[model samples]
Structures are given as C-alpha cells and as structure tokens.
Target: MWKADIIESPPGTSYRSVMEEYGYEVGKVIGNGSYGTVYEAYFTKQKVMVAVKIISKKKASDEYLNKFLPREIQVMKVLRHKYLINFYQAIETTTRVYIILELAQGGDILEWIQRYGACSEAQAGKWFSQLTLGIAYLHSKGIVHRDLKLENLLLDKRENVKISDFGFAKMVPSNHSLRSNSPYRQVNCFTHLSQTYCGSFAYACPEILLGLPYNPFLSDTWSMGVILYTLMVAHLPFDDTNLKKLLRETQREVTFPSSITIPQECKNLILHMLRQATKRATILDVVKDPWVIKFQSEQPTHEIRLLEAMCQIPFSATSNRHQSLDYHI
Candidate 1:
C-alpha cells in the first residue's frame, strides 16, 4: 500500500501544511546523510515520534531516484522483522521525497559504544544475538545489506538493535543461481547482481577490499564479526593509523588487546567470524556457535530453531584478492 502511492500527488505542498494534513507535527532535524536529512516528528494521532527522512529529488541523479531510492523503499517495505527498522510511509513530492521511519530513542550503536568504551560480554551478548538475527533475516530474504557499520545499527529505548540503512542492499534469490550454466558459475554469485564494492573500510570483508565480486551474505557476516569485536573491546579489531597498513593487516590475522579480559569462547567466535573469506563463519554458523548459544540468555523460539536447522548446510567463504579496488553507490 505504501509503495503504490509513494509519490505524493499535487506537488509543491509546503512541508508544514503536509504534516498538518497528515496529523503530524515536524520537529528538530536529528540526522543527515548523502540522500537526505532526517527530522524528528510527532504523529499526533498515534502519539509517537518517527524519523522523517527527506530526500531532495532535484539534487539526485536519474538512476538514484528511479533505482536506488525506490529499491530502498521496496526493501524496507518488505522486511518486517523486529530487529529491523519499521517503515510507515514513503511520500515523494516534485521537489523532495519523504520516508517515514521508526525513531530509535537509544540512538545509534556507535555513540553508545564510544561512550562506554567496551561493554561487558553479558551486555554485548544480548546485542550480538539481536544483530545476528537481523542480518540473518536479511540474508534469508535474499537481500544483501552491503553496508553494515556501527552507525547503521540503531538502538531503541530498550536498547534493542534495529538494523537500518538499506541504501546499498541488493536482493539475490537463494535458489536462482546466476552462473548455473556458465564455466565460472560458482566463482561468482553477486557479479551480475552487484557490480561495485561499498562499505566502511574497518568492517569491510576481504573479498570486497580485494577488488573482486563478493557473496553478499558472507560479507555481511564478516561485518558482524567486526561489530562484535568492537563492542567487546571498544575499538576496531584491525584499526591502524595508515590505510595501506590497515588493508594489509585485514589480509592477515586480527590482533586483540592483551590487557582486555576476553573469554576464550568470545575470542574463538571472533576468530572464526573474522577469518579469511574461505574460512569465515556463515549466518547459520554464527547462530549455531557454541559460544553464541552459551552466552545467549535463553533457547531460541521455534522460528530461530528452524532457521538454525535450515542453515546448517555447508558454506565456504568467497575468493578474495589483494589488488586495489573500485566502488560505486
């Protein structure tokens, strides 16, 4: 329903008048990004505050408006899990586009991690489980969240992790193989679906950094590892003052702080998740991990049990490189 009537008709309506008509009161600007500015607004009827993302149509390219933005809205509309951001509406005017989204009162994970330096394993464990479920849900839907950084992981008032920002998400059907008949079929999966590599450097996977096409699922899992490490230790697992050095380091093993008191299981989980593309953990592997299970507060529900069983099939990491890479939106 939201997708069918995304673009508002009778363009050029003042934003204030539009809000009043919808029984909403616009408030302060809370965030900004390349696509738009996000404002905090009150829904008078619902008595809830929502994030209103406003995108300027004129400043965007044809492909961005017709392809990227529309695709983003479509993805958000389809995903309805608790760990993911909830979408209410998409309104496009002649001058701009407005996306009504859930507002996370706890703010982004980045700020919280920065403030606390490092969270206890008990605390991090809860967040990790939620984060993993969110990513797993995306993968199950055949959607590859190309970008997953601390900033994209938002927290609600209760500190529940809600994975957000689908600007680079690409859908690849699980059973629909692109290379079924090609000689290099298994060599590449996301080659045709997504041509460019994009993500924050610190958390990006080896395959993406090496200028090669990647399996979006595994790459997302790798980012989860980086996220876990950061949450446990307060800093990036592979941080460096030099970009070249950092890139070189990601190819090798990750280093942990000696002074920190990390559990053996936590360390092992990070090791497996942050391994080379060929040896890294799959989504199911993360869920089935003994450490993850040990730290998790309770048994997963029937749905999670089904996912764990369903994803138990074997999966290896994608091929990677050390060459310079190129990227696009």
Candidate 2:
C-alpha cells in the first residue's frame, strides 16, 4: 500500500515502466535497510511468492555491481547451510536491481528482541550454535560476512534462524586469508589483532580494536560472542558515541555483570570468544565443547516455547536482572 514513484526511489527509468514490463504485483512492504526496501511481490505469469529487494537506480552502476552484487551472488551461490536464507533469482530493472529471494515469515531477530527482553540461556545456545555452524561453512568457502547484526538475521516459518544480507560481505582469494592494506584496518570492525574483522562495530573483537592483523576464521567467532552476550543480557557489551570509544571499551575487556549466574562453561565460552585473536578458540572447538554439547542436548521445542512467551511480553517490563541478567557492561 505504501507505494512511491519508482523514479524517486531510484532515478532515471520510471518505476511504472518496470511494473508494466515485468508484470509485478506490488504487495505490502516487508522490510527496510540503509540501502533499499524489501517487499512481498508476486510474479503474474509465474504466480510465485517472492521477496523483491529494489536497490536505488542512482547507485546501481556497473561499477557498483562489480564491486558488491557479484561478490554477494558468488558467496550466496556457494552457501548451503540450513541457517542461511536461500537466494532464488536476480533480475535487472531500468532503475533498480531486483534480487528475488526466499521470504521469511517471522521477520528478523531485532523485532523479537524489541518485543521480548531477551531469550533464556538454553534458547540462546541453540541459535548461537546454528549461527556458528553457518559462519564456519562460509569461512570454509573463503567468504566473510562483514555484517552479522541482529537486523540482518531472519527467521523462517519453522522459527529457525537464517543469515541474510551480504552487502558488506567480501570474498578472500583462495590463497589469502587476511588483508594488510585495508584503509579501515585501524577500525576494529575491519581487522582483529591477528585476524580480519569484517563484522559490525558493536560486536568487534578486542584484538580488532587494537589494529592488529587477525585470522579471518576467528573474526566471525568474535562476532558470535558479542551476539551471544546480547541475546542473554538484553544489551550490548560496549556502546559509545563513536567507534573510537566503543573500541577502547572493548579493548579494555568489558563484559556482563556478575549478578547473572550463567553456566560456568557458557561463561568460559564467552570469555574465550572475547579473548585476543591469538588466544581465541576455533569455531569447531567452541561448538564441540562439553558445555555446548550439554546445552545442545536440551530441546529446541522448549526453547521455542520460551521464545514465544518472551516475544509476547513487552520490552518495557522489568527483567529478571537479579537472577538471570547481567546489568554491567
């Protein structure tokens, strides 16, 4: 219902032309991001449900496509993890590039977080493990997902997490594992202390903040650590007015408060993940940890139940900080 002039969203070729040429039945808007908008649309001839991501025509130059879209397609083509959203097709329009993909009914993890305070310990473990496996698979294929924030992760009808968005993702050559010449090298989100940091500023590793070159493999591990912290604690471990202060706090080893009684193994895992790049554990090792196994033995059905209950609760409600939450960051 929220329709806009196609030329306005992207310029030059009118959106009216594409609608007439492609025969697209515009439906309701489903999501929005910094670059574009996603809508649920139906192809008239094919009669199939698809998610159409329309990027601005002003920025859809061939140079931009060469720099970002192709890399995204290549990485996505190689990825087949269960927790990753699947790409169906890609179409080019006069004023926009339409990326046709699988549609997630449950929206994103950010919506769930805003509605519910946070997930239970057991629930966090399941999603945490799933994300680790998916990221490990991407690394195995030489693909690095630079942005791994809550807003970028979507969920399917089964309530399983699906990693989405590859605008910030980059592919490392088969022989190369790290970057030494990136301008953002000083930024923690670009390089970890002995590793390459390609994730969000909020979830960057300490080694990354220190401007140390880091292993590409461990970059995702650090982001996963930050995500786990947020899922359990309901807030980021480090927040600041700018990236510098954020980096400083992360480098100084900021963490959750002591009031929360997390399992020692979970606590250890979080600590291990937040350590300097040289000391951090591998994703395989973390996934294979005894604590992780014990946590996995629990039922996801129950976790989903808890998730559903929490999703119904308003974020304005007080949290169980004394027993389950860590107030200090």
Write the residue-wise lDDT of candidate 1 on 68-116 in tens digits: 8888888888888888998888776688888888888888989998887
Error of 2 at 116 (Å): 0.6
lDDT of each: 0.75, 0.63
Q: Please list the residue runs of candidate 2 whose C-alpha ends up more than 4 Å from where it truly belongs after superposition.
A: 1-24, 43-48, 60-63, 176-198, 207-212, 295-329
Q: Candidate 2 residues 292-319, lDDT tens each? A: 6665534334323322332223333323
Question: Model 1's lDDT to the true fold?
Answer: 0.75
Q: Stretches of candidate 1 above 4 Å error?
A: 1-7, 174-193, 297-329
Least accurate stretch of 10 residues (summed lDDT) in model 2?
183-192
Q: What are the TM-scores, per candidate, against the unseen true structure? A: 0.85, 0.73
Candidate 2 local distance difference test against the native: 0.63
